[model samples]
Target: MTDDYIYHVDGDLVPASEATVSVDDRGFRYGDAAFETLRAYGGTILAWDAHLERLERTCEALSLEHGLSAADLRGRIDETLAANDLADAYVRLSITRGVQPGKLTPQPDVEPTVVIYVKPLPRGGLEGDPVWDGPATVETVATRRVPDASIPAAAKTHNYLNGILARVELAADSDEALLCDLEGRIAEGATSNLCFVRDDVIHTPTTDGPVLPGITRDIVLELAREAGMPVREGRYEPADVLEADEAFLTNRTWELRPIATLDGRAIGGGPVTDRLAGLYDDRVENLCYE
Candidate 1:
């Protein structure tokens, strides 16, 4: 986050302190932007294809065509990493609907504002330390997920006020906010995906609902399935998680973090979480570190 690092803004590399966007930019005024948070290990961006696919889907949902190809974005990210001398890093790529008429309705013609920035993170692999300090303590909040009907949940846009409100309700010591849908079904954390183990089966809220269909969540599900673990995705109540044998959160930054307690109940993670974490590490090691 320091000004010392270089940032890529609108196709040009600029010093972070000097990078600026117009006040009339639609992304700033209306949160009309889509973005992705990615992890890099040994100079390789993990799950590049999956992340790109998700970004494209989000852009489609917004109906804002940012005229930049995958290779163009990739080159920018590569230059960012190289410029910052970061082998292992946290990368954020954002594309905004450019300055438009100061009206709610977006214009048909679009000039996009694209930016890529990265910050160093600890090494991540078989022999690496977790980016998170310890198991997370979570609190179920009153803020319900915005229903998919209201807003397409698939878009990873800058309109994060919902998540922000959810976080504001979290306990002072809590690491995440678990949001339920209007129907009282578990949705996801403020920024991470939820997964629990019960009767040796993994359960997660279906993306068909308000869940973000996170790239990390999809990878974990596939890894569990390929490892012969039973996995189910559907609507699950908060009680289901309360009674789960093991629970964990997944995101690009955290990778995986066990839940130490939920709603003040100590339903800590166990062997199942350990196994899945190991599998995820194996994946990272094979793909990026090996």
Candidate 2:
């Protein structure tokens, strides 16, 4: 709250303000970092193990050194929450390619800079009822999600310029932006994974395309399977999403949001979306309290 807590830098707990990395650090200069945003509830971190697994995957994909083991990182997060006196808040865990003075070459001697910050959850539509008030609208932006060839789309890396641009454009017109790949196939939203319901089947873009395998997205898929709904992942076009019976977006922050409209057409949330949204909420409740 007051920014007066300890952060896990290298292997020590340093003051929030004093936890600084060199300006020449590649992460500072070129956005060479990987991070995750976790939610805490009922004095416990939600989905701690899944979040850490994704973080570890990101670090491995980027070839960055994460000095702390999974247990060590979890301990630091627990300590940080206690130090800040926060039970229900958001945790930002970041690891960057450590300080380096030279160009793009990887510096093996520099240890990765790990930072954990706790902040109050932003109050907006996120806490409202699970059912969307109206049809969720989507805006097509000029920017496209990064192609797999450029950077593996599955990893949650610091390179987010494309997503930032899409978000800016969407904020001006609609609640979220729908992104397409270079080939014009619907990739995903700026920050969340896209899911559509048609004929009681749930469909999402495949990892082979330009889409982040969101933690929340994975949960929804599991929930759908447990509920006996057919779910598949494959290439889909914006038109396909528009024509679906129901559509929604999923992410850690939003959980599951029903889509009401695409472009200007009215597309109400389908029974599948509604049921899945409820199921996802129940999962969250259990994770937060259990």
Candidate 3:
């Protein structure tokens, strides 16, 4: 609740307290919205192109013809961040289907609602501390991921009930809930992507499954390969993760947080995890903190 911050709403900068979307908006009434969670480093939005690409993909998935280009959206984010004097921040950009008639079907003509908001965070790099207190405590939940057939796995939409329900099943002290697909194969966390190491090799769920092809996840894979570490992507069971030499979660915010335990069993934070984390930090330092 960044009450002191400024927010961009439909191209206008407004005080956070005044930022609002109408009740008639499809995004508010039916969750017809696409959003991106972005990380800003030294006032520069990290992977701006990649995040925009994914956001555009989500809008396409929702058929939400937001009449804004990447530059238009980026300007809004830049303006909001500047308005709040934010450099390192947790930023969010959303495009939703604007107010429409109360009907099940959507109309071809669209006037989308655009928004940008930010919350400051500690600097990220070799010289800065991590946002997390320590490695994450994770638990494998019974709530399975929604199949791609129902809702395309790649779409980062506002309809987060699936993730919310998964979180509802997490232990009170747990930091994350790991979700598996319908076939009982490991998928990903409610908000992050899961990665595990075994015998010096890294493995993650294939995007062909019910996994959200994460931007950070792809970047980590790139870093691992550049660091000469083995990487593989495929379906695996809970046993595979639990028995791994190490495990971790990745997202724009967390970056890379090693898993402390899975299902109350100790399982992560080894040499491999440390090395990959350092490599990730090095990239951030070179790209943003330099």
Candidate 4:
């Protein structure tokens, strides 16, 4: 379907181009908003309930009104996908603090703006490309991920200039960039969560670490557990990642992608990574189309 298809704003389906908010909207001027990205496959949204819960959590963190219930939001997403005539697509759910007067304080009387947009999934390379047979090279950027004490990096908020800058550096030097905290401990990739398999155990940075709690990350962890693999969430140093048996990045768009190298060091797909990928594919197929 074309981009001109209707999107759901608040509770109504409206033209995509017409879905606009005021310049004084808190989300626009002050980055006061929360969002969630989900994948739609075969007319079903993957892990919808989880995504919505995270969104609600983000709103709660920001003290913004959600303006809708989880069930209502899911219904709107379903309707938006149908209106766009896309069974396989990407869903963006955004909740802004709404329009307020010229000040930093939020207007309690104003209702939050809730918008849902459907976009076609990215091309072959950005997602799980068939060429993704090995570990991807990762470079550590100069920019550090925001610590949770300052902004709670786990919240999926609109404040992402730090991530954007790191991604730019990665694009110029490496396939991906590994972020660290102010203290220089490994956090995660710019846009995706980091998962590495070492000695048959899967390790990822904890939510307490400076990284977003990615939905794909959770899914991978669940799949790993179901496969009877041990999963650990804790602090990981760059050296630990470089010496891992296998490594991959996970997110909504890309799902799971193998990383072949980090800073020119050689890393490739191992048995554990391959098994995890296979299990992920099976789970998605069953959950989305069953």
Candidate 5:
């Protein structure tokens, strides 16, 4: 997040400190933007197709004009990696609804604001370190996820006030904030997808509700299925998660993290978390880029 790093603004590489957007930008005035977070493994972006496809769908749904092709964006990311000498890095791609001064609604043909950059991953991450060897603690927040009726939950838009408010309720030592739907059903973590293990089966809330269909979450589900583990996707209540044998969170950053406790209740370690972690590592190591 330093100003020394190189960044891309509308396909042109520039210094991070120099990257700026107009105040009139809708994305700045209002959270009218969509973004995607990706990571490079040995200079390759994993699940490129899935991430790009989701990004495209979000842009289309939000009526944001993204004129660049996936291949073009891929090439640009590669260039950024090379320019910054980053083999393994955290990449954030954001596209705003663009500048429409004194207007709440964006112009029909306005060009979108594009910002892409790479940042150093956390310690023990992407450096062949064991980031999720042990369990972590999480807390339930009072804030509920914005219902799908208001805005598509699957879209990675910049309207993160809900998640931010949830984070405020988390304790200083908590790893994440587990948010529930308005009906008091478990939805997802603040920024990560939630998954639980019960009866040797992996259970996650269906994306039909207010949960982001995370790329990493899908990959984890597929890994579970291919490993012959039973998988279940449906609407789950908080009791279902609290009573589960084990639980974990998934995102582009940590990949997979085991939840040790929720709301002061201890969820013990299990073989399923270990198995899925191993499979995740194997997949990352053997990932092929197009």
Candidate 6:
């Protein structure tokens, strides 16, 4: 039997394959949308409030209205899980400026499109004890992130061409692509936040740059500090990152992934990264939904 999953689009809950939005959808036509990626542990969503809050802020930044209430969206997420019989899953929630005609400008009465998809997290680790598949190799691509002055990085817009291009240019052996900001400083990974270990200190690029302030990034910083690891945030050059003793990337999914190589040059193993990963796991198990 085929295991069919359910998805929610606008106010309709239907089979995943059948869910569709209009071709005129601004998200489809001009990438006018905001989104959030969240994971549910067991039946509870981790950082639901934070994700929802960001979603709201992003929509606001784009002048798109979030017509649904937070409680309403939460209930819909619960329903999606139940319909699909999923206790642990990855969910992508997107809100778009609804169908606009063949025009560049949105109308005054444009409705919003809400879409959420729930899928099994195939590579996701267990609830309490998550495991990584060893260190990953990341390469710096020529594509640079759009500076904050050009487009607000804080808005998780549907415009991911920059990230897509970086991934396209990634080396065949690389697991991810490291992107630079307009200033040639280390910005972040195509899809994750960048962090490095040097002299027993944890360093990450300041969000004052074009980096997206990720929820997991924030949690990792707090966990690192509590574990007595000195955490520093600033603008970092490629040489600094390449010469670092060790480095890792973080995002809502993937959580913590240590970097084995930068442009195929070996970066040594990090005991501090190991310690922080363990602490992050503890925090996920006990403090995730709390």
Clash count for each candidate, listed in order shown: 0, 2, 0, 5, 0, 0
> Which number leads on lDDT?
1
Model 2 Cα lDDT, one tens digit per residue, 155-242? 8987888888888876554888889999999999887788988888889999888788888899899989988899999998888887
TM-scores for every predicted model: 0.98, 0.88, 0.98, 0.91, 0.94, 0.94
Which lDDT tens digits does candidate 5 get at residues 1-290? Answer: 35489988888999887888898888889988988999887788888999999998898889888687787888888888788888778898888888877777677886888888998653322236654546778998899999999988878888899999999998998889999999999999998999999989899999989999999999999999998999999999888988999998999888888888999999865799889878888788777322
Specify the poorest-scoring 10-residue window by lDDT in model 4.
122-131
Clashing pairs in 2: 135-260, 136-260
What is the per-residue lDDT of model 6 for residues 133-217, given as tens digits with 9 covering 90 to 100? 6677899989999989888988899999999999999767778999999889999999999999888889999999999999989
Q: Over the stretch 1-290, how does candidate 4's per-residue lDDT look in tens digits? A: 55597889878999988887788888899999999988887777888889878888888888887567777778888899889888878888888988888798777775788889988753231233343344467887899998788997768998888888888887564677889998888898888899888888899988887789899899889988887899999998889988998888998877788888887777766888888777777777777766
The 0-to-1 C-alpha lDDT of every candidate, in the order given, reads 0.93, 0.79, 0.91, 0.82, 0.85, 0.84
lDDT of 1 by residue, 1-290 (tens): 45478999998889888889999998899999999999999999999999999999999999988889999999999999998888999999999999999999999899999989888999988988999888999999999999999989989999999999999998789999999999999999999999999999999999989999988899999999999999999999999999999999999999889999999988778888999889999999999988
Better of 2 and 4 by lDDT: 4
Which is the better candidate, 1 or 2, if ranked by lDDT? 1
Candidate 1 Cα lDDT to native: 0.93
Candidates 1 and 2, the one with greater TM-score: 1
Model 5 — TM-score against the truth? 0.94
Instruction: Judging by TM-score, tell me the better candidate of 2 and 6.
Output: 6
Model 3 is weakest, by summed lDDT over 10 consecutive residues, at 1-10
RMSD of each: 1.2, 3.2, 1.2, 3.0, 2.4, 2.0
lDDT of 6: 0.84
